[model samples]
Target: MSSVSGLVKTEQLYRSQSGWLQRAFAWCGWENGQVMANIRAGRMLTDYGRYHLSRKQFIFAAIAAALVFYMAAYLFYHSALVSIAAAGFGIIAPRFRRRSLLQQRKERLKLQFKEALFSLTSSLAAGRSLENAFLATLDDLKLLYPDPRTELLLEFQIIRFRLENAEPLEYALRNFADRAGIDEITQFTDALAACKRSGGDLLEVMKRTSAIIGEKLEIEQEIAVMIAQKRFEGRIMMAVPFVFLAFLSLAAPDYMAPLYGGIGYLLLTAALLLLLLCFWAMAKMMRIQM
Candidate 1:
């Protein structure tokens, strides 16, 4: 009877301890179940413009940023408190990095789409059916991309599969555009759908659309080249303040000694904030939306 009572008490104690641990983790934002759910959702939600970072990449980025910020903080303030505070920014750095990567990937995908349209136009003009034209475009893309898994190629494969399964070409194109989430792609898909429904000359329509998209992409490239110098200047300007401060600290430590503590720290903080705001404003100004 005593053994049975002891066993029951032990089991109850274990359950209580486990429950307490779960609550503690939840309070600390470390709920295992929730974290797993978020990771899974992030993986599953990845689409054209949404990229997922692997666990290795995320950990590497965080550690790299933490170390860089820690060094920068120590260099600027020579204070452990400021270094720790700056290290905290590393937690969010990976998110910004991932967003930048996604944007670049989208831009590359858009350019690839423009190239695919040229092949598609040629195939259609050469008397291939729309479905065959996509297949021909895929082949051409394979030659240009040298990758069997490029985004445009994958999209074309999906559309080809849908067409083979008896789905309407218009439906497939619409779905592709929706997934792509690019204004240019959406416009092309709309035009294609309208042309198909009205039984218009698809070859001419595709040729015209391809020409327009190609011209626009060329113009955008030219604009990027024209503004490249301005972008470089903006970036240099953003770095000038930090570089100057670092120089002052190294070249004349006594000169910057007064900015080390007390009200000096507050002033330094305000100055850093102002510099960040200026950098952000300059970056926004340099970003030309095409």
Candidate 2:
């Protein structure tokens, strides 16, 4: 019986060692198949303590806080109101910061995408395959953009890992689209999958797509220039009043004090808010869908 127990222990140790070896190889790019499987299942690296949180986690956190507040209110009635409010605020603070960070990351990603696409197109035109184009684009992005470039590179690494795991090219491409949330990428992935399955002409498709993308980018640049001009004009117009008022107040404080303190403040605040709303609306309207 003791001998059998010892043999079982040895087998378990061997299995543990094998698992460790598999994981190490996976991290080193040897296990692309498993990496692909993980990506298709939406299990990527995440920092719950910092930027991103799942919707389910957010809901659960809110529910937990609500339950805690309900219990506190029930037990102490009015005495624990302050504590309950404080606890609720604490619970919501993390959610707010998480959302803010996600938005910031998203904006940075959007800002970098035009250059990324141009780089990819240039690489494709130079006779590089799609995967190599993306890899090259990642390097170009790292040099041109900021932190979001690093995020995009990490995504490319994840996709490469997935490919190593024996995941199909289509599966890996689909995973890339889902992770990036980019419609252009999703369309490109779908098109590539179709071409692969049917043995179609990928080079032609890429060339045509690249030309169209360049034209659209040109139009977008024109729109951005117009918007910037409008924004600049608005700023100058808004500043003119303040500048005139400063001169007036400094030149004749007794005469202009009431006007500057009352009507000027209210109008300035209203104008600023209106300008911000307009800017936000214009940005949303100008967002190109893919």
Candidate 3:
């Protein structure tokens, strides 16, 4: 009991020191009201862009619905069907923004996954157990990547919060997945759930998964390098026609005068649109997914 008490005291002291160190390293930056306002607007639209809405959020939704109905009626005084359609869009916009944020967060997670795999491997090799490895990797990741690393930290914090509150791990993990906005996080959380239920070697499974991710990333990098020249060529080829036409128009306006006419202008617009569409398709085709 004495030794355990001593260890707890030491941990508390160490944590206090770490907190002081972090504060010492913290930066004070300029604040902007406009930036804050934009952030607040985004938060309002998506309810902090979270997976679930709270009681307050429900109340806010009720208020927004009432406001929308008022606005729709006001607009209806001017135009009926158009106002109704516009109100319908206003109602649906928030939901679309929420889903779009989730998609963006998921893409960020996918980008971060490769780096996370290596961090996990390093943590495991450094004699950390699976849970400790996850915690340590979260700490290491804050500097290594971008906000998706913060998302991992958020998950860890959520888990810690639930444990402190005596909440079930399964419930906490499911909630964490809902907040994570990534399929891999959800899948991994499910795998953890399975391990907890079946009582197996979770660490070994994590290691194997890490190795597979590393191999997959290697192949992806190789493919990216191989296509690098083609992508560059495609971009250059796109610019060439536009540049040539611009130069020709400037040098000999009379010779290129037909391009400004009715049918000629229409054809030119169609050509540019088609060119943009083709480029977009090529870019989409080149994107390799795991």
Candidate 4:
């Protein structure tokens, strides 16, 4: 109880120290209304596993999408109107980008969570109680991820705050698992909660749990390494058709001109549709959902 109270006081002091700096930034207009809104959204970002793309991220993605689609369409149909119309596909770019960001965030969380489990398990083996082990894990986490804003570190802050407020470790761990949306973390939490309820040996259960989850993550890392080259090759292959068309148009404009109208236009449309379908299929196939 004394240690927990001390932690709460320390947290309060740290936040109070940072508050004036934040207020100064706000007053100076360095963090204006729009920046403040995004900062609020970013804080809310911790509440869920899904990512919300900010205006800037979405706008940049949309512009890149529009440019790529326009270039491909112009290469296939030499018509300005058709190229501009195709660029409207930019509307869907943010959705795909958000999914990609969410996946990346979750993967990073998975790796960090694995390290956290190791630290927690070590603390338990060293004779700390479960709650103490959690607090001790924070020290290890700080060393492992120097960034103050790293997602797992923020999560530990939340968990520690809950602990300071006298919440049970089980409930805090459950909330973390839910927010994290990671299978390994969820399983570890479940196992932990069950062990606590059943008065099972904490050190033994944690050791086994950590070993199993670490092995799985290591396997995933190996698979990712194996598929990395293939994914790169896939991206290069997708760009080949557009590059070839641009080359032909530059080197032999007359040869490519015949394909810019009438039956050639229809053929190009079919080719573009085929290209899109193939691109979609390749993306779906390459995404390993494990």
Q: Give the residue spans of candidate 3 off by over 4 A.
A: 1-107, 117-131, 143-149, 168-170, 181-183, 221-232, 287-289
Model 3 lowest lDDT segment of ten? 24-33
**How does residue 170 of candidate 3 score in lDDT?**
71
Worst window of 10 by summed lDDT in candidate 1: 25-34
Model 4 C-alpha lDDT per residue in residues 121-163, reported as the tens digit of each score: 9999899999999999998999999999888998998899999
Ranking by lDDT: 4, 1, 2, 3
Best by TM-score: 4
- Give RMSD to native, each candidate: 5.7, 15.9, 19.9, 14.0
Over 4 Å off in model 1, which ranges?
Answer: 1-46, 226-229
Tens digit of per-residue lDDT, candidate 1, span 1-290:
99999999999999999999877534322325555567677443236655666556666777888987887778667888889999987766667667777777788888999998888898988999988888888889888987875778777878878888999888988887877788789989888888888999999898898899889888987887777888888888877877888888989999899888888888888887898899899888877888
**TM-score (C-alpha) between model 4 and the true structure:** 0.84
- Candidate 4 wrong stretches, greater than 4 Å: 1-45
Q: What is the TM-score of each candidate against the true structure?
A: 0.80, 0.49, 0.53, 0.84
Regarding TM-score, does 2 or 3 come out ahead? 3
**lDDT by residue for model 3 (186-229), tens:** 66667768877898876777667767656765775577677777
Q: How many residue pairs clash in each candidate?
A: 0, 7, 0, 0
User: What value of lDDT does candidate 4 attain over all alpha carbons?
Assistant: 0.85
TM-score, candidate 2, is: 0.49
Shift of residue 238 alpha carbon in model 3, Å: 2.5
lDDT, each prediction: 0.80, 0.61, 0.60, 0.85
Best prediction by lDDT: 4
